[model samples]
Target: MKNFKSEIENPIISKDILDLENKIALYYEGKIDEARFRSLRLARGIYGQRQFGVQMIRIKLPYGKVSSEQLHRIAEVSDTYSRGRLHITTRQDIQIHHVSLEKTPELWAELEQDEITLREACGNTVRNVTASETAGIDIKEPFDVSPYAQAVFEFFLRNPICQEMGRKFKISFSGTDEDTALSFINDLGFIAKLNKGEKGFKILIGGGLGSQPRPANVMCEFISVDKIIPLIEAVLRVFDRYGERTKRSRARLKFLVQQIGLVAFVKLVKEEHKALSNQTYKIDTAKFDKEIILPEIKIPSVKIKNMETYNLWKETNVIPQKQQGLFAIGIKIHLGNFYTDKARLLAHLIKKYAANELRLSLRQNILIRHVKEELLPFFYVELKKLGFAETGYNSLVDITACPGTDTCNLGIASSTGITKELEKVLTNEYPHYKNNKDITIKISGCMNACGQHAMAHIGFQGMAIKSGNLVAPALQVLLGGGIIGNGKGRFSDKVIKIPSKRGPEALRYLLNDFETKKEDKETFLKYYDRKQEHYFYKLLKPLADTSNLQQKDFMDWGSNEQYINTVGIGECAGVVIDLVATLLFESEEKIEQAKASLQLNQFSDSAYYAYTSMVNTAKALLLTKEEKTNTQAIIITEFEKLFSDKIKLETPFSEFVYQIKKNKPSKEFTTKYVQDAAFFYKKVTTYRTKTRSNGNNQQA
Candidate 1:
């Protein structure tokens, strides 16, 4: 992977952190006290979501490795401050959520005890560095990538210029060709390979997992270990100056990479990369290489006569260890989760059993390596001590999910909860489906696309819908998404929009339909794509109140078709993950009040107190349940007053009429910007607004 010698020697910290600590310390000390400091501080650096408030703390897990004590401590953090969960991100770092504002100092203090920190976790900064979670264990790997990921992470952790980059930065390393590391999904990816018999990395540039998803581009062949950091630095330099910052959605490196063309992007990176070091790269290659060595592994004396199940699991899980008779074991954890206590116990067991070797996977799972075949049973016994090592390593729950509403603020749907629900319901109803392979289901709470839904074979996006009078929401089903091969991948196709309550049933129906009608060895997407146009419209025909599903029949209620069928106020409009993020992050007290009184996030309780004078302040309008006799003008009158302070409707409607008549007309909202940022946020949060952005502020 991309190893540089000095990377781990001295880890970096952001200058912004120093400033934040001082400011927060002042806030905590009762000096310079302002009521808004808490919210401002939370929004500026701390992002809140479903569980505990999350800080997006990115712990540097070199080659996705962590110590036994560190694992326990992470669990402690989760249990103490978060929703008692730890997420192994696709980039091979750990993302903890639901961290409290009051706990920042303590959290930072505790993390430092284990050599971890939350500095530079978010903002326009370089994020946690990643590598092939299977780095050294996979036999095909030329060398251990742990040290390289560490080196890069260390070398640039808080590099002064990285404090305020033009946009977010991502980097990844893969130790083998099997590419379980997912190098292609980062802004810069390095895959271990040989150039003219010299071991190094083939560089891929400009890939990401956001709204505008793009598989990376190959830039050059086998950049030497010493040169990796320089190349990264060069790329960062170009991105820092050239990446678009005018729009937050268009601010990622992928946009610049695409805009400039991959060849040109590579050329720019190379020029800046070689400039600072005069093309030699200042890293001490020998020192970095010396730290990594082949470790001796023990062979188990016990031999297994029966190896069928083991062999099958091995086909999917185990990998080559450079040392003969030694194999890397991949222990799948459904949704990449294990208890902290369990993790600690496993840590102790693996440290003793596998000679201090550990690896994590992109799918939020854990991998243990360097074990002998004979010791499999012993490892299994130990794993059982931690609630793992059950049959079916790649079982249905071995599903992968992003930290959607579970921790992220931008999520639309509750991916974790929905994932859990899907697992529970699917297992109870269709247990046999667990054995099915290549059936990937990805859920994104929002269209910020953090969940990588755009690349899943079966993807679901959370969205809001206006059913007659209810503020009901639904998920937009997608098919045919995945990494095609190498770094090339396909985006999912938008198929049908189904109600949120019907998600599990919808999934079951889709899978059943696919299995029944599919030809021999036919994939889900193949069946889906063949009958694409006809399938969705036909199924959803009954679900629409006045769908006008006909391509030519458009909604004329709003100024444009885009704003039609919308409710009064909600976020995650025409989206899913965003709604999940909004609903999941609140405290129990806050949530109960919201549901009981129909309130918004920050203003829920206060809004109820102020607006309770008028009864039925919050009403759900489900269009599908209504009659066609509902006239447009009558419906508009009732809807217009729903957002007002009085119980009587005509007064509000009259005011709205007067206000609209007073304003001069310009372009429609679909083609123009409106100073309704707050109103816009509500539409998305409430799932009521029909107007939508084409996702990410970045428009091609």
Candidate 2:
């Protein structure tokens, strides 16, 4: 590996990149544990892929907003380091796969040149903050949520409190009651609102989609914009203090909220008020308040070869902006995959004619904003030149899928394969359905729902089916899931399971059935609800038969050979650290960070770091006893019961730890908290040393 240059303008970002470079060196030299190093690299957006020796780097674009220069830079970097391919995720992040781990720091440095970032893009931290792609242009929106979303993203980008949590946390901002950002399925979802012309948000907390889907509860009907930040800070403090640790499956904030009732959880969140960094944090929306600037270039005269196709494109791809005389064009990207060649061309197209900005949609497409209505014909022709003028953006034909068997290790079957076949079916056979936006079809390689299969009107989860001694790729068909908007939604019901080869047939059956049985002017969700889950189950039940299987059926899509289940460890969830020594080492690191924070006058951050250090230290000792430790709340209570009598203490462990809530995060309390954590660490280390010296005494 070559030495990395630190030419970054921001001192903080320069140090961060340098730290990553140093850690990479340490890990290669066998100084840092692989698990700890993985966590560090993941927080910096360097993720391991299914393929060995290469990485998938997720570039976090806050709210999916990307400028032409940044897009060009991303394309250039992809061509230089990656395979010239960019994969847009459902969360509105772009992922470039197959890059050398050693080159990630340099890649990040180049991205930062265009004000882009990969920090906190992946790992057990605050993931990308996504909002409606039409946020600023929505006709029904009371206010543009772009600034608020950007503020939240900026506030938590490198915040120490969320850097290393038990599991990943997600936040979203919906433009209006339509909830295009899908607030009902995030850790913290904010819907924009106005009361008497005062800007505020309706908050939803603890919703998520995974193997187990849970809808978020309404945390508050309306909170002023200034108080949103403080409320979010308080919730994060509570989660950091009490969320699950040992059990990775139950560690998400959603699970925590489910275990403890919402009322009690809110109580815990309120208790952290004194420790909040801000009681009321106001955001400056002036920068984003400006109207989008459109290029002054005259519209080019282009002769349409086919007026019918152009009209269709205008109807489906062109969207009216809230601003007069401007329109947004939606480019329906296939499977969210586009190459750098087309990407660079698109970048040039936007820069030359539009507002030089594009927002990637959650449905794996692109939205070109600020295009003059006169430029519609020119855009359609130019985009057609780049092969990006696909109609049916976000319609039934625009299928959403994850790179299942292609890149993700948790993938069980081929999501992209079935997606391609189904897309072909929709495009070639049912052209009339291109305008249908009511039905959404989503696919996941596995039950984890990275593609949001659980929330789709027609969903398919990858599975494996067995017939006697033979096994074949399968999909669990689900139906009736759709967003009802306004912070309310429902998960799809599992209908049936069919072989992956039959996935296309399954879709045809469902569509044909709905087309036949549905009453006039009836929506898909209403029809499904009326007919119930059993109707769909029985309709597609014949395809579920695994008795008659062919060799080709055994093979998954996009593969020439026979199918084999090669699911690897998923990095979406944080790595598990079972080593007591590693836990103790991390505790020491946290203590040092606390001291550094205190010196910097970040008292609230310092206090939280100290609190985390105490929990880590206690958990390390408890692990040695082979005791059950799941959550931070449990660790505090259990440590007191198990170790209070053994160790000489000035105060009870519960009272000592709970002092964080009782007192404000002033200099005095921050200093006291840090000192207490240090003292507790020393005592725990002493106890461990004595126990080992006493010949492994059980009670030591």
Candidate 3:
């Protein structure tokens, strides 16, 4: 492979890309283990697909902001490196699939030329930092959250503290109390607020969606803008230290908070204050507060082919911006899939007429901002040519679906196929719902909720139902899930299991009953509350009857052959290697990183790296004894209990490790900590070698 070091301008990013190149070489040479290499590539946003030998590259766009030039660059890279398709995720990132593994570094270098990054887009790092697409223009917002979200994204991108955690951490910033960003489902959620003319945020912590969904707890009703970053850092430090590690199923921050009550978790977070690099980080809002410059070109006159269709488009797709006459247009992408040809055209349209920038919404759609009112007709006409002028931008017809069996390894059924059918049902049979924003529909390939099905008003999860001797593709219908606003939301309840072919019929039944029985002007959730879960189960139970099955019932949507369950190993959490030798090798690597950080005068980062090295060293030794090490906290305690007398230390093992929290990350303290960590590693290595020589080696 060719070197990408010269192509990337930023030294840090260049090094990162070059490192990926070198690691790929090492893995091919059998020098690096598959699990270890998998983690490294995943952290760089290269994911394994359901198909063998191809990769999915997730581009991390902070808060979903993308300029026309960046969009064009992405399209060019996609066309060159993979298939000419761009998939917008629910987290506001774009993914390109079916790329060769060897070409990833070059692809990443190309993206960075336009200031786009893939670092921390996947794996056990802080994933993309997302925010409301209408953030800067929302009339109800106290202030724009784009700058703050950018600040957090920049601060933690390559930070040593969060490079590897037990599970992925997600954060979001809601522009208003409407919570369009869905704060209730993130690890750290911030809602912009103003108290007595002072800028701040309402913080929500420890929320997630999977097989189990948990609503976030209100950590603080109001915290100043400057304190939010520090607060997040403290929370991450606590989670890294005590969160579950061995069990991938229970590794999320929500589980940690659930295991040890909120009060105790909060106390642990507070204990991390001393080691934090900054007590408060004031974001430079002025950088993002630039005045909007409208285009100087004359408005083009376009004849409307249909006045009625134009009127409906304006009603559902056009949004009036907070600025006097400016507007934002919403493009409801079908299942968030669009081709490069249409992408280039949309990019050109936005650059010449509207704002040069656009936001990829959390709903897997696009929001074109700063569009002038006079250009509306021209945009509609131009977008119509590209098949981009679809109505119902965020209404009931705008369904969100993940790339299920299409590419995901864990997909049990086709989310996109069923989504296409359900969307047809809404458009052809229920046209009036094009303007209805009261109900939302989402579909996920599985229970992991990548499509955020658990939080939708009407949701479907892909599954397989076995009928005695045969298996068939099925959908788990869930209802009553929706955002209640103000950092509150509810997860849907499972009502019934029906064949994927019956999904459209199930929707018709639910909609028909809702239309007939709902009270005047009642929302979907209110109506659901009145009728209850059992009521909906009874309403849709007939569709669940599988005794009378057809030939098509055995086939999944979009598949020609009969259904066969072929779930692969999921790479969403990355692979974890448990080899004792690999752990020791990783410890040495961490020590080198600590030494490099110390030389660069990054004391806080050096200290954290050293702390991690010590933890890895201890965990490796404990594994030699076949000890049950599940978390950093448990590793610390168990190591001390088993080896305290054998190894001499200046202080107790707990005190030595806990010094990272107790002492400030000063030069003297950091230098001593790194030296202590090195000494501890040497001792453990010697002990392990002695044990192995004595024929006492145990498999990890």
TM-score top scorer: 3
Sorting all predicted structures by lDDT, with the top scorer first, yields 3, 2, 1
TM-score for each predicted model, relative to the true structure: 0.67, 0.97, 0.99
What is the alpha-carbon lDDT of model 1 when measured against the actual structure?
0.56
Q: Model 1 misses residue 334 by how many Å? A: 3.5
Give the per-residue lDDT digits (tens) of candidate 1, residues 10-86: 32233333445566777768763443343334323354444443454445465577766677777777777766666
Q: Candidate 2 — number of clashing residue pairs? A: 0
* Local accuracy of candidate 3 as per-residue lDDT tens digits, 1-700: 6767678768999999889999999999999989999999999999999999999999999999999999999999999999899999999999999999999999999999999998989999999999999999988889999999999999999998898899999999999999999999999999999999999999998999999899999998999999999999999999898999999999999999999989999999999999999988989999779999877999999999999999999999999989889999999999999999999999998899987989999999999999989999999999999888899999999999999999999999999999999999999999989999999999999999999999999999999998779999999999999999999999999999998999999999999998999999988999999999999999999999989889899999988899998899999988666789998998999999999999998999999999999999999889888997889999999999999998779999999999999999999999999999999999889988887877744553
| Cα-based lDDT at residue 186, candidate 3 | 98
Against the reference, the lDDT scores of all candidates come to 0.56, 0.91, 0.94
Give me the candidate number with maximum lDDT.
3
Error of 3 at 117 (Å): 1.1
Model 3 pairs whose backbones collide: none
| Residue-by-residue lDDT tens digits, candidate 2, 271-343 | 8887788889989999888867776776689999999999999999898989999999999999999999999
What TM-score does prediction 1 earn? 0.67
